[model samples]
Target chain A: MTSKQKFLYFIYLHRTGLSVTGLSLALLLFPLIEDNPYTLGLTNLIAINALVVLGLNLFIGYAGQISLGHAAFFGMGAYGSAIATVTLGMPPWLAMVIVAILVALVALLIAVPILRLSGHYLAMATLGLNFVMYTVLLQWDEVTGGPSGFSGIPYLSIGDVQFDDEFRLHYLLWSFVMVSLMLCLNLVRSGVGRGLSAVAGDEVAAQALGVNTRNAKIKVFILSAVLASLAGSLFAHCYSFVSPDSFGIFTSTDMVIMVVVGGMGSIWGSLFGAALITLLPEWVDMFETYKDFVHGGILVLVLMFLPQGLVTGLIDTIKIKLALRRRKNVAS
Target chain B: MLRLENVSKNFGGLPALSEVTFTVPKGQLTALIGPNGAGKSTLINCMTGVIEPSSGQIFFQQQQIASLPAYKISRLGISRTFQNLKIFPRLTVLENILTGLTSEGGDSMLMAMLRLPYLRHRERSLKLRALEALDRFGLADKANWPAEVLAYGDKKRVELARATVGKPQLILLDEPVAGLNAEETATVAEQLRLLRSAGHTMLLVEHDMDLVMEIADQVVVLDSGKCIATGTPDEVRCNPLVLEAYLGRMGATA
Candidate 1:
């Protein structure tokens, strides 16, 4: 195949089957070695969280917007779905759908005002909004169950199939994660992605080209929020409980770090970041007492040496050096 | 055709463009020439709806367009290039031009969200058009190269390619050849001549006297935010008022 065709083929395979194969391989190996469901359950949670991070990558990395309150939107989706299922006695699948739509609407409402401001001001606005959301989630006792959090959330099911067991939920979460990643990949490859890149590169230029910069920002923000909410709902159903801590400031920061460390503007990088961030704590648990120190040290090193994030920085440096060598050879 | 009547702009009591009036005829290249701070850019801004005039009317093709936004004005068959190069740095040369082609004002939100096949087809056609634009500017070979890596002259050429890719009826070129070497300047001038031959109407704001004299069918000289002279390039070049505005007392004698 020609190089271009080869590249496209690689992208196609990576988009469609790579995740499926990875999940299948993990499942095949998972049962033979381990019987513990807790480890598998946590791993599944990480995979779900990674999908949410992938969505945020589209907004934060590709669109170049700061979102410190992403977890709040995720929390909203979780709680929205939980409330719909428990309080309102709706079916789980229908409740999830309603929760996604409501989360997107809330995101739109928030974006209308916040998108007008950019940079640090935008960051602060999102951070403050997240804090307010956390307080509301805590104080709204009757519906949300207050600080104790919501309980008895129904397990997720579609038709006759139930995802109450750890393995079942793992496969289901993986399915959604793959779908979200594929959607994100396609979105970035489209004209909408080009517009977002233009806005990120230079807002004024994008405006001069007749791009509605404000509207684009709002749309992407809402899309990202909806995805986060979907993950939140899934998480709530998986655990059969919902809590304020799951959608707190720390959770938001964790998502941001995942996207940044993996690579900004790259969906796959966000996945890699999510996987590493999620799995590293488990590996460090062997140290037990020094787990936090090891995690903190890794973050510091990653930030200090690879500020553009790990994946992109390495790729750029290698490309530059190769380009320089090619130019020298041409001159000779 | 474009006309600006009684256009006035104020910055908290200081006048930037006060009662400025002018008309640019259809199918001709008109030069807006002025010394530093003569409100040349401000006039362009007002005409393009980047700044709202305090009291004035703008007519493009005899239609009132004074209150419209910049993008809306662009969509209505008017496009512009900036004084500072504004090419998307990370995008490829062809992609930059494709942006101009795909930037119609009417794509629906549903279409954008769904990634409709028709939009995809339009995008493919735009890419082909972008390639043709690159070829016209002698940049077809560099179509895949990142815009940021191009030299300043090539970047300006790419910028022009982007602006004109939409095939707009009227194009506003703000100092198109600024900061170019003589060779690159000649290339740009040749391209402008080619554009003019293709029956494109151009309103150029340029400081390159030789280029302006060579390409401009008509010249409008502005002094202190008002048009001081309007005539053919040679007529304006000889007019005492134009000379005085450009060089003061010595200009008349010279």
Candidate 2:
């Protein structure tokens, strides 16, 4: 095969690799051409948000577990890292790793009881959990600084190089996003991923086929919680701020909405959903007063027509159309 | 070999299966036949650890497996199919079979996420076995298609292929040929016979008396959670109690 043909074949073999590479290139070029700090900041937020949603999507979308309290875990990461550095006297970079381990344990303990619930019960339980976390963040004045919010989160530095520049911070965030995206891509094709999908499809059937559904559910839950907490840690370091209002119950609900709007089980849906949700406010700014109304209306349309979420729905439709056209060609 | 000793399951004071005792000899097929509420499903559930028996011990290869979890019991070499057809609808045909056969090395999260050497080794072996299974079931052509899109009989065959591929010592086939046409039912019966000839123990819970008579080395009859008869097909056919139970139920319904 020609080099072009060989490259095309390679793309076909590693489609997610292709998409991630293309995305990285686009993200790299996006800020250089358009040097608006505000737009760059928004893109950075999109990457961060996309990271959290990827875990949330794996939990709800692939594992079929409902989580409405991921914001609590996210807050834990932010506060955990902040407290570790500010009070515990840990290194700024080491604090993220330390806080991640602490948050993962907390998530495991919480998930034991939370995962016992099914469907709407699980949603309600997580919703209540986010409220409790919000209340705690507001009430804990000494450590978290109460309603005024926690501040002075140190910038993450590599050796002597501080990520103080906006472009550099953006790159730092995307690096994590890229790792998370590739990790998720590998997970979908992995054995554990198949087991999770099997459990999601039917718990009894999965168990019959030797999949430990309970363990699978718990593992996915812990993984999701850890990701949310990691995102929180990144958020704190990314913006140098932490607030109870930022990790409210609505934020938890928003995470679920992102997964649903993206596609329930599609791996690429996380990026698509996060990007849409993050950029949507700017788009709706065109209709300044009726922003919420326009946003609600557009979301309703997306759901009404694409119940499986945009990414999977589009693919399914294309496959069906292609099959129909093939049959028509054969018939003619 | 597998044996169930005095296995009893009760739900809210109602007995689903009471004191059911039986043995499935190695490499032989035992047909468990019953009426609508004969507790055949409940028995299957107990054997496969879907439910803990209210009382009794289950022995597989002389090891008591009654208290084990369902998945653990499955790992201990018991596989089953659902009467309602519990195929994963969203997964493709090949994936469904791969799910059954991929339990060996790919189950570790770290191994899979890192694409470790062992995971690749398992994947390659599993793909070979999965392809072999599909070819055996004449499903190679439909391997890439989603299980939901398959015809009802084809889906049933896929479920059977999934249950039988994982090298389980004993397979519980709950109404394997239910909802199948005459030819399709014959094909499934032939497949069961092939499995038996290969020295795989099978506990077939089926209502098709003709199919049962054709393939069953031993037959056990159940009515109202009680095992009323156990013998060769001819012996069971001649048993007064078996005739009375079937004829009496039919007469009452008529």
Candidate 3:
């Protein structure tokens, strides 16, 4: 093979490594190329959503569990950090860590009962969880600021560096996404990942093959919730505010749509889905007013045409086309 | 290697398996033969901890395992294949085999994420073993293909490869070659002989009488949820109860 061909072959062999390297380079250079704060802010939001989607994909796509209430976990993270840093005077970094742990514990507590359910029932239970959380954020006026939403949250900073602007925060948030993407990619190739895939494919067969389906589901659920919580914290800090409106049932549904549109079992698909959905409103003026209609339309279209999710389906099509072309060349 | 005593399973008021007892000796191929609805599947399910027997004791290597969950029983070196194929359709064939290896020496989800050198080494070794398993079943070339795309006979071979990849103490094959064509059946029969000669204890539930008669060291015949006969193949073949309930007048004419 020529050098270019050899390089492509290497990428095919080590796709995860290529993804990590490519993402790192993009995150580092994208801000330099586009020095617009408006674009930077949207990209930062994409990174935050991508973080949550990566973890959610592990639960939904790999472990075969459903959680439609991730918005609640995201809310818990944001509010948890907001309360700790603003009201209780805790450090922002410390607050983020503590809230993430608390969210994980909460997920573990409810996972046993909620994950016992599958199909539409599981989806409904999680949706109900999002409703309960939204209600609490609205009704608990004493702490959460009620309908007005929580504000005055400060920016996150390291020892000497502060992520005070969109440009600076892009690095902070995308770094989280990059690391999480790497870990998730590593996980899906691991034995535990195989176990998750087994459960997703056939839970009974997975059990027979010695995969602890129940435990695997619960672990991935907690992991997914914790990531959503972390992303929520980052979201709160980036905007310097917390709001019930952002963590409603609609956001949860939108997140699920992102996973479905990205491709269920593909790790890279998570980032693709998050970016596409996050940018949709910016690209189309009609998106906000018809958000539900557009989201539903995209979902229906994707399901009908690309049932395996956009990225995976596209890749499969390209592969088939390439193979057919190669066969024709050999025949001639 | 496995012993079931007075194992009876009831669904609602009806009994599927009643007072069924048999022993699968170590390093022996035990063919479980019976007519339709004779409770052979139920007996396999009970032994593998898929379902709880209403009243019975199941011992594996002299330890009571009747109440253990399927995964725990699998961890105890017992593995099984489903009567209907349960291949992980989306996973690659190699990954399907790797799933079987996870019951032993597998890392936790957290440990896997860390990607430590030792864990990477372990993963590489495990992949090698999975590839070797695929080679054994003539599926090494298709290791990267999604299992759902494989032909029916190839899917069955994948299931067999998955079951044996873990090197379990006892393998309960629900119906290894049930729907296979003659060529596939002969290939599977050869694989069984290879597994047997390698000293793996197997409890095969199959309807292919010739495969069983050729490879089985012992045969246990069940009729209507009861053990009708158990002995060497020659002995079970001559038993009038087995001939009547399963082998029928065909064996008598032969």
Candidate 4:
């Protein structure tokens, strides 16, 4: 492949590489180890969360829409998958498909009204929606198990093959994460990406240029919600149990922090953000008491000194300095 | 051809455009001239469907279009530049012009998403077209530069390049030379004449009377949402009603 093609291929493999390499290294180093299941499962969970965050970044980072209630959509997916399996007696694989579609439809319904709002109004409206969803999950005991959440969720399987163990489920989740990340990268680099940027830059200019800005925003919002829901479903089946706490405002905040700390509008940034935020707490176990304070301080530093987020800001500064040096050389 | 009939716009109780009517012929440059608060911008906004008139009908190509959205109006072979420069700042100069090619089949969201062969071919052709448009406005060298980095006069020209890139049947230029220097104004006038010669119809709203007189085939004078005079530039310049409207209130010479 040409250098450009090689570069793009490298970017595509970067996220999936981390998961595969990490898993392989762990296996090779600790061939006789038996107590590593928790760490392996948690790593898979972080990768899955990164997939969902990638979707959110496409909608919020590229499309410039605020969605604080993405967790509600995530909850819907988990519940939808569980009910499809338990109530309808469907296969877990089929349940996932049904749940994804159901969540997409729900997102469409919610986006139609909420996407009309802009800025802080839209943020507050989505926040209110998450609160409403929490109330419903708390009161709806028949299906959601009220505060206890759902249990006995079936294992995901393809035909005769079942992902029943942590090792098998890690591969499955990583495969989906790779696919999701690739889809997101393609989306943001396409014409829709330009349309989203135009909408974010200036709505009136976008409209005058014949872009259906409202429709574009709503579509991205729904797409993001659907992806989040898919991740939630996988997460539920991974543990064979899911509670209201699994998909709540705190979950949404975690995703937001991932997107923000990594970089707002970059796909790779989302992955970077997810990995760091997810793995940092585990690695910093000694400083457990000051975890929140440290994370908050990192956020403040990123906002104050690197407002464009880590990756983009660094790239821009390098480009600027290089251009200046070239100009100076030419002049001299 | 375009026609506006009995257009009336009211902001609360105050009238912005009241019963304004005019017809612009095909392949002719028509100038809309008026003093401040004379409803010139309001009339352009009404025609472009930016802000709907309180009551009115706008016809373009013998079809009613006042109720259509601004983007739809643009897609129907009518493009316009803003009084305030509205070029996409972060985009390059070429991309700004490419944005104007909205009706082209190659740049659809689906094609862009899939990155189809046809989309790549169209994008290449669009770059060529954008270059031609920029060259016409003497901005070919700056095609790769971010639009935010351009000077004010160059930015105005970029906006014009963007508006005219679609090869629209009619282009509404709002104050195309409002803040331009003499040389820039002359360049814009020359570009407009070239556009006219190339069979593009233009409706210009300009405060530069000299530039208007140099190129206008017909001049329509508006005062407080009413047409004061409609004639050739020379004839309108000599009309007593236009003189009264311009000098009677301001105590200045025409």
Candidate 5:
């Protein structure tokens, strides 16, 4: 192939790697520019939540599956690690790996029948699942501290290189964040991604296109659950605490809202969404009593104006305008 | 290459098709013509496994496929276009065709995440094939455009490209030119003829009698899901039973 053709092919393979690179660069640079412990801690939390939201996006955003009980997977990961370490006496890192696998298997089992549902039925199914997970976490206090929450979780360390410092933790979280983003980006343009998009657009038509719609939905759901599990493990380690309240139906709904406000189906858009939803509350703290009102108003306005979330809507606008300009140029 | 035996479909105690049997010969173009509610779409659905027949067997390449789902049937070298456009509206035109290409490594997330050489190799080959399909449909320049923005006729062409991009053993076209002008219909007809000449077996469910007669080597007529007539275009054209079924609207509609 000629140089131009080779360049085009590269883009066809990656669908433009510029955004992924930009995200990596900004994530790496954010802490260096700030350096404060509070900012770093907040950054780590954003990364953690973004990680969970990333998993949610895989199901809700990319594959067009509705999940309202993602926090159950998140909670399971947290509690899964706690039980593995405190009860089983396994190492922290080993607990993390095992929890992820366990959660994925559970998700696969749960998804088989649930994935068969469409539209509101699927949403309701997931919503009920969250309640079941939360109830188990509360009543089964023998391991989960009886809804009061669990503490004394061991800090994660890798020999001499400990993730103890706030700055190190921020780096650690972003490291996983960047890797997850890379994997997601690659998957989005891959066959699985297109298949998910196809399933989302029209299940019947996607099936007609030779896409196994239910199987595709189940695979993506398992992946997102695994991702949420990983994030849950990290969340427990980050605070050195675990709780049922942290992984409840409300959090599950919040994750869905983040996926929507971030831009459904856009990985880059989710990052912006995670940052906005996480930081926006802090930014509005001055209102104290009026915070909820202000925060909700701002979100409503953003949706009313941008509609498709900020990043995706902006990108689409630019693309449409560019196309129109090209046509105008040709005509004039 | 495709055969249906004793096919019957009933929706909630109402029979849509009953004991419909037909054969589409290998390496030839066959047109299925019927009036409104003649169960043409239902038959297409049965042939492509979109909906299971109430009773009967569908054979493709001499294998029973009536039990298979739509996706499995397509993977087994049977593909179809919808009476209404079913193109992935948000996807780029090229992506729509690429979705049908069925590259091996892409089906697995790990292979995709690692960007394995084999997956890359498949993508490169698939991209070229998709671009070639776009070119054949006169859609090369519009390959990057979202399919929803294409003109109606162009969307039909895109659907055709998507169906045949997999190089299936049989292509099922349901109302391929229902909403197109004469010029657009001519363009699509020419494209179908090209596929037929290229040795691709096609089963077309269409309404335009003129185009059907012009292109189909043989024609099958259905009324309320029963095979009313099956013969060459000339033979079916002169059949008194076929004319009477038209209910006096026959004229040039034949």
Candidate 6:
């Protein structure tokens, strides 16, 4: 290969790494460019949502599994951390780590039976799990603070550096997002990733090819839950609050929408999906009463025109346009 | 290397296959031919452990495999292609072939997630192996194209490449050339012969008489889920029961 061709090939092979590095750099510079706490706070929320979406996409997009109960895991992380730090008097970082591991174990227990159910059946089961968790958080009044919500949660810290404000919390949250992105990218390019794709494409075929479809589904399900739980911990620390209302069925549904709107099977799509969905209401604040109506209308339009999700659809459009231009040039 | 004895399958009191018996010798192409509803598919399903047999037993390499799941059967050196195309539509052709190597190595999910050096080496080696398989099937240039985008004939070849990529001890091909044109059928026939020459044991389920007669080392004919005749192609071709099964009794008499 020519030197130029070799360089381009190298870039193609490492595109995932390059893009991740670029996104991390952009994230690091965002706070420096904009000192507005409100914007940074929104971005931090986007990062937390993206963290969950990245893992969820692996299950939904790659492994071809459904889950409507991720909010439960997220809530588990928040409530677990809150209870550990406030009621049980554990350190903030220790609480976060311990809660994430506990939530993962809970998810594993739930996944074995639930992952057996596929399609809408799986979705319904997960939805039931979310409702169950929400109920527990509400009825367990003394511990969870019930409908009024839990408060007095401590800010996360590393030695002396405390994430007390949105600006400081932004770095912590985005770092998690970047790390998760890198791991997820690494996963999809590996052997297990190929097995997951095979399962997603056709479960029977995957089995015939020696892929344990059931096992693949359960593994991705647990991984997705752990990420959501970690994000839940971050959500609690960032806001210093926890509420059953925040981790209800609606939030779970929103995460699914982000995965779809961002594009299935595309990692970068997760980030864009989370950011767009989270910011949509804020952007359409002028039409307060018609907020949901406008949101539904836009989603319908997007699905109608770009069924592949925003990132993938947009990328395909650009490629097509470029190809057309190239053909015209060649003809001329 | 594989034996079946009195394997029967019933669905809701209706027998799809009844008391079927056969033995497939290793390092040879054994073609399973039958009329419609003759239970060819049911027999294949039983052999692959897609469904448990209603009665009797199946043995592969001296191990009873009737109760094992499909993946376990595959891992025990049995692989199969589908009647209808089941290629991973969204995945690239190379990735599709890589999936066949799942039972071989690099199975650590944690190592994959961590992007460890061992997995990186495994990925590269697996990719090279997949590319080699694609090359053998004449799909080398289209390795990066999504499996769905390939033409019907090419898709069949991709399935063949995938089934053989892992170098399984036994391959069950169901209508491998069902939708292909004459030219494509000839291509697949050549690949099958190559596999036979390489000493791979294959059970071919096909309807095309000429291709089977041309390439099969042994032919087993089924009529109403019973083995009517089994012998060399020329011998089975002249069997009275086989003639009666293919043509009606009156036609056979004529």
Task: Estimate TM-scores for all models.
Answer: 0.90, 0.94, 0.96, 0.87, 0.94, 0.95
In model 6, the runs with Cα more than 4 Å from the true position are A286-288, A298-305, A313-332, B247-254
The pairs that clash in candidate 3 are: none
Model 3: lDDT to the true structure: 0.89
Best by TM-score: 3
Which RMSD values do the candidates have, in order? Answer: 3.4, 2.6, 2.3, 4.6, 2.6, 2.8
- Candidate 6 falls in which docking quality class? medium
Which is the leading candidate under lDDT?
3
DockQ winner: 5
Residue B80, model 4: lDDT of 88
CAPRI quality band, candidate 2? medium
lDDT of residue A72 for candidate 3: 96
lDDT string, candidate 4, B1-254, tens digits: 99989999999999988888889999999999998999999999888878889998999999998888877887788888888988876566777777777556334444565666766676678778989999988888778666766779989999899889888999999999988899999988998999999999999999888999899999999998888888999899888998888735544743
> Tens digits of per-residue lDDT for model 1 on B1-254?
99989888887888877787888888899999988888889888887777888888999988998888776777788878989998987667877887786465234544654556776677667778889999999989777666766778988998899889999988899999999989999999999999999999999999988899999999988888778888899999889887777945445465
Note the Cα lDDT for every prediction shown: 0.82, 0.85, 0.89, 0.81, 0.84, 0.88
Give the Å error, residue B85, model 4: 2.0
By DockQ rank, best first, the candidates go 5, 3, 6, 2, 1, 4
In candidate 4 the C-alpha lDDT for residue B188 amounts to 88
Each candidate's interface RMSD (Å, one decimal) is 2.8, 1.9, 2.4, 3.0, 1.9, 2.7
Q: Relative to the unseen true structure, what is the C-alpha lDDT of residue A185 in candidate 1, on a scale of 0 to 100?
A: 70
Residue B135 Cα positional deviation in candidate 5, in Å, after optimal superposition: 0.5
TM-score between model 1 and native? 0.90
> lDDT (0-100) at residue B67 of candidate 2?
84
Q: Model 2: per-residue lDDT, tens digit, A15-61?
A: 87678889889878877887888888898888888888999999988
- Could you give candidate 6's per-residue lDDT for residues B1-254 as a string of tens digits? 99999998899999888898999999999999989899999899899988899999999989999989999999999999999999987677888898889876467778887987877787789889999999999988777666665678988899999999999999999999898989999999999999999999999999988899999999999988888899999998888888878735435566
